[model samples]
Target: MWDTEHNNGVLIYLLVPEHAIEIVADRGLARCVAPGEWQALVSQLAVHLREGRYEEGLAQAVDAVSARQAAHFPRRGAGTAYANELPDAPAVR
Candidate 1:
């Protein structure tokens, strides 16, 4: 659930197969995150992706890139869209 209002709330759910109750208590996570901070999170996620830590990479990617700009921004294979995307390709190993 995307809570733009930044309200603190917990999501409680029951796991049938595990036969347990899952409680995601929002203590720190519910707080509003800044854009730069979020960008840093994305950078970290890319690092994680490079390191082959798939789960961490995915978490960081989703948290970082999942923004208003994501919709307008191209996923890949393009000629310039955002300023971040360089026109020239980097040297490949």
Candidate 2:
């Protein structure tokens, strides 16, 4: 989370065995987002997971988080390119 340049990194962790989800955001992003918004996203993801839609749920969660990040930390210019600081794929253990 602290590795991102904009300090807006987010991690969505899913505990499959416990059917639990956790969303961690960096300080910059956390201050801009309300707790209820995070809870709402988690609730939506939980619904999809409970229905056995793991991939769909995860994809939606990623999209939602991306949208939030974009809204809070937009690119500086239309032609500007930013490096992806985090891995694109999720690491499952």
Candidate 3:
């Protein structure tokens, strides 16, 4: 349900109770990124979480997602500038 400008947005749901994670990417980004790539991030998160590194895991996830996003929808200044369409803070509910 998380999507933004250029239809490029991703949401990583960390289900603490169920001890699982869900990665959701919009159609625009979905076509650009491989599912395996997303899986690897999820797996990485799990590993960090398993070691009780909640903050570190979340931080890594953000960095990883940013790298992937930069690849597909790079920042173009002035002429084709980018405006963040979604909130920077993570959604909990």
Candidate 4:
């Protein structure tokens, strides 16, 4: 996140066994999205997790966050590819 030029970054951290979710956003993205929105997203994500819909919940969470990002920090030009700064695969500690 510190190395990114755009100053916009978001992370959705999940601890499935603990039933915990953390939505983290860098300063640029945080400026536009409200904490209430994050709270609501987390609540909805929790419901999906409790229902054993892991794939669905994750997809929904990504989609929801992506939509917000798109609205706030849209790309300047059409068809401009954004480099994958972070790995797409899940990482475990």
lDDT of 2: 0.91
Q: After superposition, how far is residue 78 of candidate 1 from its true place, in Å?
A: 52
Give the range where candidate 2 is weakest over 10 consecutive residues by summed lDDT.
1-10
**Which lDDT value does model 1 have at 5?**
26
Can you give the TM-score per candidate against the true fold? 0.30, 0.94, 0.87, 0.90
Q: CA lDDT of each candidate?
A: 0.43, 0.91, 0.86, 0.85
Candidate 2 local lDDT, 33-53, one digit each (tens): 999999999999999988989
Quote the positional error of residue 59 for candidate 1 in Å: 6.0
Which pairs in model 1 have colliding backbones?
none
Instruction: List the candidate 3 regions with Cα displacement exceeding 4 Å.
Output: 1-3, 78-81
Per-model RMSD to reference: 15.4, 0.9, 1.9, 1.3
lDDT leaderboard ranking: 2, 3, 4, 1
TM-score of 4: 0.90
Looking at candidate 1, what is the lDDT of residue 42?
Answer: 46
> Residue 42, candidate 3: how far off, in angstroms?
0.2
The candidate with the higher lDDT, 1 or 2, is: 2
